[model samples]
Target: MKWSEISIHTTNEAVEPISNILHEAGASGVVIEDPEELSKEREQVFGEIYQLNPDDYPEEGVIVKAYLPVTSFLGETVDEIKEAINSLVTFNIDIGHNKVTISEVNEEEWATAWKKYYHPVKISEKFTIVPTWETYEKVSSDELIIELDPGMAFGTGTHPTTVMCIQALERTVKAGESVIDVGTGSGVLSIAAALLGAKDVRAFDLDEVAVNSAKLNIELNKVHDVVEVSQNNLLNDVKGTVDVIVANILSEIILLFVEDAFNLVKPGGYFITSGIIQPKKQEVKSALLEAGFEIFETLTMEDWVSFIAKRP
Candidate 1:
């Protein structure tokens, strides 16, 4: 079925509010692009990046992309869809054939599309992550199986940053140890830690959907008892110290919570951190060291780096 692509332009500050308004007005989903997500060079190279500076665009700054199923809604009439969009935002709607294309996709086909990038990922000698739809012919029975379905939130074991965090968790966590996963998206690393013998694992995320999804995943792995998923921001509501703390978030966030993360770990406890781009590795390392952590090991994968440190 053909789809209608609705691009809404607003201010960076107004993106979320405008997206919500559009959603309430019957838009299926809204994709918000933050200028910060792109570098200056990337913004210039890829015209896809929308600049939100008031001086640049003046009135229309933030741009949101929404796809409406033509066959499902708006009566497949350009005028109807245009009227619906105009009701939400003022825009010059460009009607073009093939502006939206329909392609046949099945479960097998969809699985294959991601398979070229997703593969059997070994988090540790005793643990491996395999996509729910993929078969792991080489995995030994001794290894723990982590069936991951990376739907929306970040962790999928496909990204180097995620895999590095998993490996660090496997090497650090011990049986009967208490663990905390900050910014626990998809609960992949937290669940993996629980499977690796962590006695009690607590995970927190900023997104409520992520919390719900993580709970579902925890149940899927039969780790409900060991893993506790909650909607929180970096242990703000979580109290007490843990034996190991795993945070697979951006370098800036890591730096922001470096002290808090350090305090969360008991003396000699481990802190495993990823989501650090190569350029920011040193910065993260310095932050951890400044927070009174002793650097243990650093692992690099692709453009990301994972660091392991110990309190005291």
Candidate 2:
């Protein structure tokens, strides 16, 4: 089947809104790309890797690419899709034929695609993250199982940073303690905390999509009563101090919000941080010290580090 690849370029600030407009205009799926996320070198590398036939990569603020089968009729005309996209910002639109052929993908094949990348990930001696699509018959019944099928969401416990955070959670969070997970991608840590005997757990993310995804994951784990997933920035909207806090965000954002994180934790509460690149460990440690936190322990995995610190 022939497919039309509609490419639209606009500023990063306008990409999401424009993508929404195009979707409303009858595009099945919109691929949003942030220009800042891709450099010239990256684009060239991507083109070479995909062996793109058209061999064109846009260099602009932000780009939204959509593919629709020619036979599939859009509720709106091509001109209407173009005009709606243009209204979002100053953009350039290009239409091309997709050299890539389409094929039918069944549920079993789609499930295998994700399962291939996931394995029986052992977070600690007592905890293991098992993808729902795969069996964990080798795992002992005494171990805690976190059944997850993270589809397009952040947390799968496979990422080094996520594993580091999970390890930290296992070691630090105690029974009956209140926990708050900031930027709780996939709610893995939060759900794990609940499973580990956290009395009260609340998770929040800046992305609504992530929040919704986390809600689904929370339900999947059957921890809805203990873990509450919501949309919030850090702990700005949360009230009172939590016994423990977990944050798995970039080092820069972690440093920026260190003080706020400190304020959200109880005086003797612990704060666990991950997503620190190897080169930025000292910088993050310095920020933690400056925030009046005493570093307790640090775990490093594949150049990523997770730090456990206590607010004094």
Candidate 3:
């Protein structure tokens, strides 16, 4: 079978939203080729470091690749994807070059080729994200390993936005506490909260695909017992307050539910928000404050920003 590869040359800031656009367009998965991967510093304490090929990456910005089966409506799907990505500019997100191109390839080539890009990486002090395909051995007694496949939806949980949220979970999630992970994606954050000893974890995503993908990863991590996966629009049907509420979605979406988050967090509990670009950090912070959350800690990686706000 043949598949069309849609490649977009864009900035790192746009990777999350663009990948989401492609996923919504029926792409099963995405391949990110960022030049920074060639020079990234990895801590060898968790496990082996997989070597990256420089040729696969763009010299500037990032390349997001997704495969769509060859079909008669392929052209229209591609056009819609391009439009969706371009629309991100209205949210104050920089789209960079935004050069999009398409090429045809054999299914055999991409079916398992994208797996090579994922490996065990220690994203935070206590959490290391290991792909389900890889075998890893923990080097410390207190290390937490999260196994994920990211099958057909979400990411490998190594994106800076995700890493920051996991780190925040480590700092805030206490044993027996309850957690609500908004826009759970592949359910990585919910799993982390469970592993960190949260007794009850709830994961919600509007996309049914993401809900299923997260359910698989949650079970893979053996946290299904503690985490409940469901399909819901951000806090719309949510009831009861949780000890910690973490969201790693676009900042614009985060802004929409600030008051909901505030109302759903127990006193002195935390609200962790990521997937925020530098330009919109102040805007989100302002919203959180307006919702009555006290700014706790702000985490920054590359050009992304994450905020840990506490309800006083």
Put down candidate 2 lDDT per residue, 1-312, tens digits, no spaces. 444556665554344345545444444444544433333333221111222322243454545655555554643455677666554333322222212222344445433433433556666767778777776764566678778765535336655677778778888889999999988867888988998899999998887777877887888889999998888877775788898999987676788788888888898899999877676799999999999999989998655788999998
Candidate 3 segments whose C-alpha is farther than 4 A from its true place: 41-50
TM per candidate comes to: 0.65, 0.66, 0.95
Q: Candidate 3, overall lDDT?
A: 0.90
The runs of at least 3 residues in candidate 2 whose Cα sits more than 4 Å from the true structure, single-residue gaps closed, are 1-111
Looking at model 1, residue 52 earns an lDDT score of 39
* Worst window of 10 by summed lDDT in candidate 1: 92-101
Better of 1 and 2 by TM-score: 2
Q: Whole-model Cα lDDT per candidate? A: 0.67, 0.69, 0.90
Better of 2 and 3 by lDDT: 3
Q: Which number leads on lDDT?
A: 3
Ten contiguous residues with the weakest lDDT in model 2: 44-53
Steric collisions counted per model: 1, 0, 0
Clashing pairs in 2: none
lDDT of 1 by residue, 37-127 (tens): 3433431211123333443222324455554444544554444444554443332212222122223344444333333334456655566
lDDT of 3 by residue, 1-312 (tens): 789989999999999999889888988778899998788776665334666778888889999998898999999999999999999999888899999999998978868868878888888888888887888998689999999875547587888899889989988999999999999988899999999999999999999988888888887888889999999999997999899999999999999999999999999999999999998989999999999999999998888999999999
Ranking by TM-score: 3, 2, 1
